[model samples]
Target chain A: MEKTVIDAHNISKIYNPETIPVYAVNNVHLHLLEGEFTALVGPSGSGKTTLLNLIGGLDKPNEGNIYINGTDITKLSAGKLIDFRLHNIGFVFQSFNLIPVLTAKENAEFIMLLQGIKKSEREKRLQQLFKEIGLEDKTDIRPSQLSGGQQQRVAVARALASRPHFILADEPTANLDSVSASNLLDLMEKLNREENMTFLFSTHDQRVIERARRVITLVDGRIASDSAAVPTSIPHEQVVT
Target chain B: MILLMAWRNIWRNKARSIVIMLSVAIGLFAGIGVLALYKGMMKSRIRAVIDSEAGHLQIHHPDFKKDNHPAFILPDANALLKKVQSFPAVKMAVPRTLAQGMLVTTTGSAGVQINGVVPALEYSASQLKRKIIAGEGFHEGKKNEIVIGKKLADKMKLKLGAKLVLTFTDTADNLVSSAFRVAGIYQSGNAPFDELNVYVSLTTLNEWLLTGNSFHQIAVILKNDDDLQVMQDQLKKTYPSLLVQSWKDLSPETELMVKTVDEYSYIIMIIILVALAFGILNTMLMSILERTKEIGMMVALGTAKAKVFLLVLMETVFLTIAGTPIGFLAAYIVIGYYQKHGLDLSGMGKDMMASFGFETTIYPSFPSEKLVMILAMVICTALLSCLLPALKALRLQPVEALRR
Candidate 1:
């Protein structure tokens, strides 16, 4: 009973506007099934993050279209696209973009604030999320007061605050240590199973890719391979298509 | 929540926010201080003229604005005085005869303009009784008595109860003479009002000026100074041919000068407001520039660009609200203290002010309208200067911002 939540066709993106263009994403096609834990991986300049940006409605593709949950985001008006991104696509970034002035709870409640959700409901939801994320004690503290890993955890909570259908993480673990990265992957894997949330990410770290049910590899702005991953990690063997 | 966030954000940048508030407060204090001082002082000077020297309105032989003539007179003083008394705002109406004359004694003779008034009625409408430095105001229902300026009394070698002779052109321009006991001497602070003016009984002046009980124009006092225009308009409507002069028109040059100076002050106020607006704009713009990355994140987090714009605008409006009340209080305090005392210009500018007919000490006074106008200027400039910051916040590209 798998449903396709995202479909990409012939999506090509160019960073350079010149005649001799640099392709950030080229001739890439992807479809993420409902309730799937998918990871995208490649080296630097390999277009993994570019592919995620195109799918997440943060950027436009130069030569193709992207559909999220069956609606073409490319056709949505700017305001409606923002609403779409707010409700259906959650994003976690490498830098953990928490507002320095706001507390962890406020950051977690940001999407609900944008949705015009009532404050009581937003607060209640934040309390539940804070409890689950092991950040109940840190909820009232500003991001500047928190460590890098704690800030990233707050970012993850905020991304999930709106109950989005898909969560996009770009190098979410790059700034974390080995233990922190493992803990974040476990949290994502649990959310992917219990809440039936779809997860897509771009990373070079094996800790993240190891938790994915499916992996998409990008090479030179093109998709090199798309395949399912073994549930258990083979510590001795490198993952290859 | 948005308002709360805006409030918290302002406190987070306390230094910048405080600087903006201080600028607005200073501007408002100066503007309001000037307004109060001008209004209070002007009222005092004008009231002095009305109660003591000039009645609220004047009626003169039409040609008197041109020159004095023994022949120029009102046809019937009793009848016109009755018509004037019918008006409710006329606190007390009186007939006065005026002529160019000379007061002579053994020691000296000096040129004078004699005002002949019914003394009892003049008492009810004037501060003359209080200003008398020697002797007393004209006796009630009596004759052969006169009051002269303090300076004039000295020149004529006259003392209280000293008999003085007055000579003037009679109805036919013939020189005639009369006599009076020196009654009182008064000073109105102006050398011109003090030195050359005289008051005598209306009956005696009628006999001296000689036009068979036909009197000069009737003067009036109104209950409220503000009612001058309304009363004048009503009086004009009631008697179209009767010439009426309100105090403003009676002192047209003084009125014109007050308005001119007020206009100049208003122009200066506008320039200060413009400068303050620019200062606010620069501060807000700098803050926006510093928060660019944060604003970009808000946009990338699926915040509507319109909301981004609104959030920035709300931050500015919130700051202004927080500051403006404090500014208003500061302005009120400064103006209130100065308005209670007065600005003493006596050291250097007193002589110049006296030459220009302003008092030695200038005090600030103004109506509520001026205060409201200044408040509006401060608030509008602060809020308006926030436009550039709001626009900058709105024009973000989510993808590029996320990348940054």
Candidate 2:
């Protein structure tokens, strides 16, 4: 039994609570062990993003608690929760939100810089991540100068720079073409296998679901199914070519 | 890294940033330039009054200022003048016999103030000779020679060498009339002063008044104007019976002008700063609004709310810092040029300025102290302008901001 990295217990988030209430995330209980590549998949407006936000401590749940590495993050203050997220969790947005003014290397090193990592160590890790993402020559290029695929690669590198306990990616490949999407998934899979890095993604793309080892389906603000798949047995017909 | 990002972010919207900077620079220049002009005018007026009408300090018989009667005269005037001249700070002291009288010529008669001055001593103390516009100044052997203002001469329809009659009361309270010839006509650039004052030799006026050697007033000029208050204090302490006054005390209107000009400059500065603050606020707010998502992303990545506030503040400060010095430099150059050549308002306000004893041309001057004050004011304006936008940045929630 691997150590549990995330333990969420009956968390609920209600939007517009008083007038015409909507349950964005309703009483969801979930947990993930270390080194697992999990995917939260559902149709549009099914609360996948809301559940991910709760688990990452970006938003507070109205009821119940979320624990990351046995720490009850739901009880932390806004400031402390931010600090906790900085050291314990990484996030990748769907829009590839890289700071436009910074170069790729600066973007990748930004998280470590915030964490007070030493200058030499930040530079070394940034170089290794850029090389691993096949963006060694693009270190000095700003986000505007890079292609969409290259920008997403830089975003991924930034997420991995701090070596967090788990990474949460929200529709990470939504904006990418098939070729770029396939390359990104392959890179993430390689990182997961070699480094035993844990990742949780909220995605509707079948390509992402196929690569994920564990799939949790959400429907109408509740978890509808939870199952594990054999990595080699994914149907190629369902993957977007 | 935050500072670098702020700097780069300003250039992201190059046109907008430049517009804001130009507005600030132009506003500051206009405010400072107008203040310099007003200050220059006040300074010129004060200098004219001090050098021509009132010396650095003056002493008079305590009763003489209440009434112009000849009996109210300073006793031992010559000895007092000698003693005052001996002081190191006192450059020169000239005794004058003053009388309120009437001047009569062939065409008309007009009221005037008679100033009896010794030519040789008055030349060193008052520079009256340099101001003579028509006819030669007083000659060494000349008697009953008078120097009348051009306005007075024009009013009386009198010319140089023309005989004029002065009528006044003697020390015995009897009316006496004396005849004198106008030796020179002087124009002091002050219409009111030029229209009412006439000068003659003290020897002639003393004989006519039958007052012997007594004088009504003693005007003292100092080597350095900074020694005015000290010398006035010493003079008052020495001659407790007499009244000693500095130029500012004698001319309250000019002093008021000096004080009010400073106050008005600050008011104008505040108004201009308020206008600049609005421009800065608008630009900063727009910049923050456009980068809402980016700011959210930074906060989500663990940048503190305080750091986000600082980032916006730094952007405003950078914008102000870049433009303020340029405004100051431009104002300095303009004021410097006018200080050399003067800004000619003669064509516009010749009569108005002349009545107030100010020259037609004003030389603009800006002191180093005022520059420091203006810079401080600009910094304060920049900080004030950043508050609203910085607060807006601080209020952003990472979850909602990212969604936007």
Candidate 3:
């Protein structure tokens, strides 16, 4: 009964459409309600990342539409779409894409700065997020100075800074060791439960999939399965390969 | 924050940035130093011509310039000289009798332009008194005394105190001749001028020619050369029937040289700036290429394309702003030192410079206004150099760039 935060209707993306056409995302219909922690899982080249990109307005879909909080972002101009993404959606890349020149606090506060958030409010939110991510003492450290796990924690803090409707993380745990991966998932789950923060991840890691409340499996640019899962009941050996 | 990112990014590749900055500085230094030296040479040439030959302004009977005939003479020449010297801007004025004649000696004979001058007035009006390299200057009450150039003396084989005869037509169109003793030998450092000119006392020339105090030309020097045009205009108004001319009119070649040096400086500046622009472009492009992922990530996080373009531009501006002042300061120190102790071109181009009426020692000078102009040009070059790289940053697609 929670309000639907994302509504995607029959969207398709075709790559190399002029010659030897490849359909990267084909006629996918999906929706997520508020507070849903969802995972899009598929093997390599199965269109998991493509679907996430289309939903986040990072890539354009060739047909149909994607709606975030009932706004059709597929109809927006490139410039407007960037602004929309800034205010409405957060993104975490697999490579822990923090601007290497900026300190952790500056990186976290960057989106809010783009959104023209006042400095005092940005400071308040940045401080709270850093403490929540256990990186309070690492605020002045640049990405290069931080460990991989600490860097990813700062990336998560950046994503949460603007308090967007949802965050789309693409293979967020791909570069982390098991302990770092576990810690990141735990942090994300904690933010999801306590803050009702909606998240949609394109991941093949079993650790991530087991933590998601909803799992949508993709095969050959189409949804092969959509199911609900109990986090503790999902088997570790059943990770998408 | 964007500025901070741009500033920090320049230092990320310290060695590369420093190399580019140094290239810009060196190019600018070379361009400015060469321009200053050329300007100094032109200035020195102009000063030499104005001081030794043409005064700041000249007044002549309209018909006298048409031919060397002695009939065309300024009426009341003494009154005109006194009136010209009364002006506050007029530092000195002197009247001269000019004749194109032949100098004859026992050993040789050659053509010459005879200038009749009063010793004290001529000394104040021209630097000829200072240029006497051998023998003393004219003596008071000495009749038929002459000052001739060393080159002329050498050609005629006449030494100081040697007797020579000058032959020319008088005002009545009757041929006349006079004997004079060379009392002084001068070397004006100008080969052509020194080769064909001699001076005699105005009183002696007047007595011999029976021209009775009439003058062919009146030369006036100003306390400040900037008043040349104003004084020329005033003289023209005062003597409407007389032909009044400034140094620019009397010596068109020196004026042309000034303009040509200005134009050549601009051309050289453009060439240097173009070279510097290439260096800036290469550095900026490399910086942008290496930060492709970072730029992509910024755009994906909702930084506007304009912001990305500005970021690259800011980095380029910072590099130029840091380098330009250093270049200008270094040039200032070098040119200042040379301006105090002249840069000697005697070993390099003494004959060439002397032929062109320039001194062997040049004082390099840079005008403050020109310094401002060069700084503005450097900043403009930086802006122009950043365009292509900034456009490249604008063309980046967040999706594709992130993948790269």
Candidate 4:
């Protein structure tokens, strides 16, 4: 049985008081299972990101409990929680968020480099991840030099380098064209199934939700639906693990 | 890796980087140059004082320095002179008979101190040799031949071979008089000495004082003038009864002038550092603002807060290291240029410098101490200015940073 990696209960994020207390996240409860591909689908201002941030320990909840890998991250200090995030969660953003000064491969290897891994071991892991992402030729190119698909691959590779149990990608495909977005979704889906690594994405794109093993729809800061998709003989569409 | 990244990040905007560095570099150059100039001025001033007045050390009767009176003459200055010559730094020691006197010539009358020296031995002990500017030097064993300073001779309307009557009281408290023929006119360019001091042979002074073979003070010249402090301290312990005074003690005003100029160097350097530190703060703060998301992501990726702070600090350190040397080189070129062709303070500026008793002609000199001090301050400021911005980076939340 795959252990549940993330569990949240009664979490609410309140931004301002005068504006009807915008409930970015309101009493939303959810679970992410090991190796599961869960997509939180919502319209703009629906709190998809707030819940993901709470789940990723990138934020704190005003009231409630969050458990990741059976540890209550809500109780951890800010510094300890940052370490926990580094060790457990990997993040991919819409902008790729690669350090501009670093080359493409260096950006991909950044997390493992932070984990104090030896250079040789980091290089070995980087080689495999780059080959898996199919950017073996663009290793030395900087983020500015790469196409959107290539940069996202590097970001995905960077996200996976720490060997975290799951990945949190916030609107990761928002910036890409349809073709590049489809290519990235295919890569992410492959990695998800091949490595049995759980993936949580807060995205509005129907294309993303359609490929998910489980799709969660959030409306007005509440989870409206959490359902598994019917399995089909869809050989390959996305690579994410 | 973070440091390496931070360093490379500096050149991402080369013009901006150079501008920030130029601010620090210019500050450093000004700070160091000002310090060197002040210290050099003080050094030259003190050297001029010692060279013209006391050489290095002067030995007087214990009561002579404590209370100024002719009665307190060194019992037998000849005996003390013999012992002082044995010390290492002492190049020569000669007895001098000093007395408050009045000089009268056909043209005018002036109050002065008649300083009597041993013609040959005093050559190594006083500024008499360098001050001689006109006519003929006193011939050896020429009795009654006097070398009067140019100003004193001008006041007395006396020329070489002109005779004058000088009156004074001897060590025994008895009135005495001497008539001497002026042998030469001298100008040491020091107002106090050139205007008031008159030089005469030791034989003439002994004959006038009726003391036969006694003197008041032993002027001791040392090989290295800086060793005066060490020699004075040692001599204090060696001969507690004898009073030895360095040039620093001879004229408190000149000593204070040298000290004040030296202190100005530190003050001006600190002010330069303060101004430069703010420029660095602006640059570092801007840099942190530009890389906010990057730093936040690095922290999210498990870079420790301490590492982030260190990374920023290390980058600044590298920048200062590279830029400060350029500043040093620039300062060195200016100093070297002035060192060769000293800055001219002639015309109008010369008169202004006279307020501090400095010559109208200004020279630039480089001291290693001032260079080291400026470099140290630049590095310290560069590092310190990184503190606030690094803390801001530490506070950046990973997710919000990306959203921004």
Candidate 5:
């Protein structure tokens, strides 16, 4: 049986709670298992990103307990949460936010450096990750020298280099061309299948949804539907290109 | 890696960074140059006070300095001179017979302080011979010869080789007058001293006063100024009845000038550095504000607040330190050149400088301690300048920062 990597019970996030009381994430319960490939889908203002932020420990929920690897992240102090994130989670943003002054290899090695990894081990992991991402020839170049597609690939390589328990990719393909988006999805799927690395994404792209094994839909700050099995709403043939 | 990032970040906006760096450089250059100039000027004035006007130490009959009375001459002038010259620290001691008198020329008359000195001893002790811009000093065996200052000679319409009458009261309370030939005209770069003083032979003045071998003052020059206080104290103890005073006590204005210059030099440097620090603070704040998104991303990617703060601090320090060497090197070159050739202030009018007893030509001197202090101040200002910007970076929340 797969272990539950993330478990949330009745988490709520309220904005202007003193007066207006608008709920960004309302009374949501969620659980993520290891090795699971999931996509969070929703319309605009449906609180998908807020839920992702809460679950990733980047934000705190107004009311609830969120456990990551059986440790309650919501109860942790801000500093401790940051340390926890460094050790247990990786993030991939849509804008491909690699440090501009650093080369690709240095960007990939940043998290490991923060974790106090030795240079040799960091180099070893960087070599393997660059090989997996097919950026071996491009590792010495800064992000400005690379195309948008290549930059996103380096971002993915950076996300996976630390061997975190899970990767949170927020709209990771939103800025890419169709060919680059398909290539990135293929790379992420391959990493999921081979390394059993759990993946979670908050995205509006139909391509991402079609590739995900499980899909959870949010509406009006609450989960409207969850498909634990392979998604069937989008036809497989239409997204296979 | 953080240091590398900091170094690269400063170059992100080359123009802005360069402006701040140049400001630091220029401020330091000005501060250091002004300090060196003031140091040189003060040193020259102090040297004049010690070597020309007053020797390192002076001994007088306690009542003589009170009124320049010829009756209050040293009781044992010859014995006191022999003993003072025997001290190891004393380079040479010369005796002078001082009198408040009047100098009358055919054209005009002026009040004067007459300094009656031995020809050879006074020449060596005060270097009054070097100050003679015209004519010659009193030669040996030249009787009734006097050396008047340029100002006094001009005022009384007197010239070298011209005869003048000096009138003063004798020790026996009788008015006495003597005629003396002016043999030399000198300028000591001290306007008031030049205008009010005239030197004649000690023996001639003593003969005219009918006082045998009596003198009012013994001026002592030391080989090393470090021995001044100790020698003064010894002389004071040995001759408890006489008045022994150092040059500083005799010339309070020169003492005040030295103290004021030392204090003002550091105050000026601090003002310049504080202005530079504010420039740095403004530039760093703008840089941090422009990089809001980048900082937010770093924080979101699990960078600790301390690391973020450090990055900002390192960037500011690098920028400031980059300019320090340039300022120091430029100051060194300019001051070195001026020290060799001198910086002439003749354009500001020589008479004005002479009035304050300073030479028109000044040589700038840079002490190593000033360099160390300026560098220390620069570093302190740099560190202080970075705090506000670093804290501003730390206050940024990752989510909101990313939204920008």
Candidate 6:
């Protein structure tokens, strides 16, 4: 049985449709299935992040319906959309935006707390996640005390802490050095393999694109190419879409 | 966790937060200090009225207070005085023979309230002997001795032993005159009272009026202030025909002054809190502006708008709570110290204060009950102050804010 986590149809986001209109994301259709390690790759102004924002429910599209796990997120109210995102979607930003004042563990537990998870359950999950992310010792350290790669790892842990249906990461490794970026990709790939977690990243890094089982290219808010149809690198665990 | 985050967030800009906290502390300190001072001054005035001028309770003939007419004297004032004196709470009870008269000297004449009092009992009621600045009080077994205020003595250009003639209508309505020599000059700090009042021997005044054993009023002083209203109610029940009144009833102006001071204290506190509120608003707004990206991240991470508002509100509360204890402790120490030692304003001019019937030295009294209201007002102010900044945080779009 295949579960389609995201099914966005004819989504078009215009910055200023009334005056001096700019189509940030124009007339695009995208679908992501459960347990798919996919990459959304494009040059600057090619609308990779914009499309990601639309699918992540961070921004509303001017036209078209976005269904996340059978719920039309585009029709949901602002407050409902936020709750939907909280339960079903995890976001990883380019800057690894962990709350500066909170320790890495606190940041990771933030989403679960918002979900009203009991302390015992949150602690159990946090212990497993921190150990899996290789940050068990760094859990008490604030983001400022951690390196770029460590902070990104913390962000990843925070995203997974809520057990969202899927993770949407935008340029997750842009700020990291080559070694840190490679290490982060390796950790993300490991999570994708072992935990069967779905990851959809918008990035310019070829390293990220190479590891992605299926790559989707966006050109000016339209899907230019999708490797989902053609079988790519991973012969085993084929994309179910 | 939101509370912890809010608490830690205030310390991000330590200097700014400290500045706002210090503003709150200093504002409350000054406000509490001024309130205590005003309370002290008013309390002193009220005590003076009750203890020195109008004893805690007074009983008079129904018509006596209407015009101080000598003919309208209390029918059995001595009996009433004895009864009042027997009460356990009664410290002293004295009979007064009041007459409206004119005092004439060679150089000038003035209208005066001639209070004919038994020196021994009057001294116990008013402590008037301590106020005498010149000569001794009425001599024992004195025939025709008078105690006039220093203001009256100065206005008439008269010294000790100077003769003055007092003329008033006697009981039969015939005008009668008597000559008296001034024995002592006293200054009671109240200029108006000093200028208008004179004291004389009760026996001598009765003889002059040809009204034997009759007095206009009986003044009662109590041992404890807490017994005032109860004693007054009891006395009122005992003397149904006569007019029995408490000091508040006798001196409505002092009572009004006390109420006015209370209203003014609240107004002063509100103004100070409002000023401190503005400081809090500005600081929290700046903090929100600086953390736009961070706040947007939290919002995007499914932190509800209500939670965001709470976080900002809690930050302001933390700042205010941090400052409040310092303010209260400082005020307590200063007010407690001065409550015993007194804060002297004599350097500002004793005459000015005395003219207004205020003591040169004031003892500050901080009512413990007021702290609860002050803290409630401070918390309300903090909430009001944080509203704008919190709304601003709520209005943020995660996509746009993260762009910043």
Query: What local distance difference test score does each model get?
Result: 0.78, 0.87, 0.87, 0.79, 0.88, 0.89
Which candidate number would show the highest TM-score if scored against the true structure?
6
DockQ of 6: 0.77
Q: Single out the weakest 10-residue window by summed lDDT for candidate 5 chain A.
A: A232-241
lDDT for A102 (candidate 1): 81
| Candidate 2 CAPRI classification by DockQ | medium
lDDT of 2 at A112: 94
Comparing 1 and 5 by lDDT, which wins? 5
User: What are the fnat scores of the candidates, in the order listed?
Assistant: 0.58, 0.53, 0.79, 0.65, 0.44, 0.70
Interface RMSD of 1: 1.5
Model 1 agreement with the true structure over B1-404: per-residue lDDT tens digits: 56566677777789988987777777766666666666765666687667776788877666656768868786566787888888877787777788889888877788998888777777666666777889866766678798887667766767788888899998788999898888888766555666688888878888877766767777888877788999888877866656778878877766876787678768777887788778777877777777777777777678888777767777777666666677668767666666778767678665455444456666666456776677676667766877888887777676776776
Per-residue alpha-carbon lDDT of candidate 3 for residues B242-334, written as tens digits (9 for 90 to 100): 999888998998899899998899789889998989989999999999989889989998898888988988999888777887788888899
Tens-place lDDT per residue, model 6, A1-241, is 6777778878899987999989888888777778899999988999998888888899999998888888889999989988888898999999999999999999999999999999999999999999988999999999999999999999999999999999999999999999999989998899889988899999999999999999998888777889997322221123223
Top candidate (DockQ)? 6
Model 3 misses residue A85 by how many Å?
Answer: 2.3
Q: Give the Cα RMSD of candidate 2.
A: 5.1
- What DockQ results for candidate 2? 0.58
Best by lDDT: 6
Better of 5 and 6 by lDDT: 6
**Tens digits of per-residue lDDT for model 6 on B207-285?**
9887798788888899998999999999888888989999999989889988988999999999999999999999999
Candidate 5 residues lying further than 4 Å off, grouped into runs, are A229-241, B61-90, B104-111, B167-176, B208-211, B226-244
TM-score of each: 0.84, 0.91, 0.93, 0.92, 0.90, 0.96
Which lDDT tens digits does candidate 4 get at residues B1-404? 77778788788878878987787678778877776677667766676677766767787888876545677777656766787888888887788877778898877789887888886776655656766888676897678888888868777778889999888987677878878898888876565566688888877887777667888788777888668888889877877888888888887888888677777777887788778777777877888898888887777666778888888887777666667888888888898888778766567565346445565555767868556666677778877878887788888887787667
lDDT string for model 5 (B152-182, tens) is 8888888889999999998887888899999
Candidate 4 clash figure, as a count: 18
Q: In model 2, which regions exceed 4 Å deviation?
A: A228-241, B66-72, B104-111, B151-164, B234-242
